[model samples]
Target: MKTANEKKNKMTTSEKTSKYLMPNFGVRDFVVSGGKGSWLFDDKGEKYLDFGAGIAVTCLGHAHPRWAKAVAKQAAEIAHCSNLYMTRQQADLAEKLVEKLGPGKMFFCNSGTEANEALIKAARLYGKKVTGAEGKKFRIVSAIDGFHGRTLGALAATAQEKIQKGFAPILQGFSYAKYNDLKSFEEQMGDDVAAILIEPVQGESGVTPADPKFLKGLKALCKKHGALLLFDEVQCGIGRGGAFLTSQKMGVKPDGVSLAKGLGGGFPIGAVWLAKPVQDIFTPGTHGTTFGGNPLACAAALETLNVIEKEKLCENASKMGERLGRGLEKIAKKYPGKIRLTRGVGLMRAVLFTEQYPNAAVCKKLRENKLILIPAGCNALRFLPPLNVKASEVDKALNIFEKTIERL
Candidate 1:
């Protein structure tokens, strides 16, 4: 039997969600009320080490003082206005991103999906420019297992059959190629190809990092075919991959990059950076967003950048990522039959479980042990702790993870 208070709380939360919200996402029963640093607290005051980091969205962790203060201050001053005018926040944020990304222009939007859509549109315009016609060279080649976004344009670029199943007649002119295979991509690189878009570190299918040589080969291929090389760094950018952008660490210079997951820490803000050659594709009337780079969103993103640089969070991500990788490797050794291998760079790491131990089962058991993880593909578990996570926190998470595996 449940108390009246528990019944009332249920009515206000899960029950209400069941009645009102759409049945799209798999809703967790745990009601998260607050978080700090690298931990989350449910409404019942239960603390859990948050290794998922909101699927790599919260790069600075739950609530950083600088980020919160900047958001609050900008919200009080001016939350939003039409893109008809400019704000200091937008100007500063754009300038910072351009500097960090190396000679590019930034377009702001509301989420990663929107950022990819903008990139897709950019590819189309570039294609038109290359072939001197609207649809002459407008095909896009993405990886087979790549997960771009749910929006139609981004979805079309995503080659997953399961994701594209119900949505019939996906946008046309999109093709698939084997990821990290130079020859496979070359087979698809016809004159009709406009862009070769890929995630330098594929996050959803699994945290699979691209081979550096393969990325360089794609850039050469794009140059030869007059097609743009775009990188979808939404999940692996912004210090999460031990660098400002994972592609940068990989030493590949792409024509465009899509970013969003951690761009504003926890706030919703998406951005696309286009290199100088194709920056002029989107003229004044081509594209725009009303709430994309508003004062509050820009402020939050700017403060996130400020904190990452000042605290050397990128270096921290690299250092702690090594520690976490080593720990996972040890665990893999202990359970060699059950665990396959660990993949990914920096904070964007995943452990591949053998069929004997499924990902969903391990994830559920971890949650019960007060540790949060994200499931990827069929048998991979993602561990995306905050970039600024303390060493002690990493050790604690590793302890919990090993113990959980032991019990299993």
Candidate 2:
């Protein structure tokens, strides 16, 4: 039934993917051709409401005008230059971040994993400096079920066994503690402890926000042991949780913070902000990246921040998040047995389901129904819409969610 021209122009999803891409990820049935606002369009022209926002990377939404303009302008000017030279865009972005995140110095990288790796290196250097060159104070404590990244150093900091299955002999000096339990964390702390790293909100484990009291206690414990406190805000930072940094809302300051995801507004970028005391640990030769603070990436990030501020997207996230939570609660009430609970802050929300319905199945069904949502551990579905999401889109997603539950 197809014309010769149409057949020539078309290629099956399998044909397009099987040849070029790695087999690590399971590719979806449809190929995404384009996206706008909170919607994505597939090659077959099916429209999907994107609640995942590329796993919380596109905080300003798809194809945002200002972000596109900034990237285009910068690309035309200068897309990339090695770190050997300084670029105005990169410096400007750094200044903006430092101004927003308190007095600190920042190091740029390509992703969250790299940022956490930098944090790890910085912590170890600080430890060596404080406790002498041959000191044993290099162990870093992280939380159970917390996700950092897949790289060796960051993976070592991550506490999931499944992710570390075959990649054993992970870098030494990493310990695990129970999240949200101060006593469990204390058990891991010692004179040799260099840093305590945690996520403000555990996005991968299921939208688990850190308890304010637990964060405060950890800070105190770190100080007592002469260790640094590091927050991996990759998933919760850059206005994702109604604040530039979740620690700001929690009223606890970390000695260092790793950020990525929404910081670049879909461009690949990462950063680590270090407080004054330990900021200078990384001397000239200690750490570096080839294309970290390139002009195009910084321009995209700067514009993302500008839009977030000018449009007051943080305030919007809080308001819309409340609306979203209320809607989910109402749905939970309607399907008491199917839905167990809902949790999260700002737009980073989740719906926990009963054992009868598995989270993976729920996510698959949602995708089939032209809705996109991410599955977290613990039988939960995460909703990480853009910070500038509209109330109407939230309602539409809720309607689809309710119908999906009914069918299930």
For model 2, how does the per-residue alpha-carbon lDDT over 1-408 read when each residue is reduced to its tens digit?
A: 999868755967677687567878876566889999999888789899999999999999999999999999999999988999999998999999999988889999999999999999999998999988745789999999999999999999999997788997999999999999999999999989999999999999999999999999999999999999999999999988888888888999999999999999999999999998888889999999998978998999999999999999999998998999999999999998999999999999999999999998999899999899999988999999999999999999999999999999
lDDT of 1 at 306: 98
TM-scores of all candidate predictions against the true structure: 0.97, 0.96
Give the Cα RMSD of candidate 1.
Answer: 2.4
What is the alpha-carbon lDDT of model 1 when measured against the actual structure? 0.93
Which pairs clash in model 1? none
What residue runs in model 2 are displaced by over 4 Å at the alpha carbon?
Answer: 1-11
RMSD of 2: 2.5
**What C-alpha lDDT do the candidate models reach, one value each?**
0.93, 0.93
**Model 1 residue 124 lDDT?**
91
Q: Can you tell me which runs of candidate 1 are displaced by over 4 Å?
A: 1-12
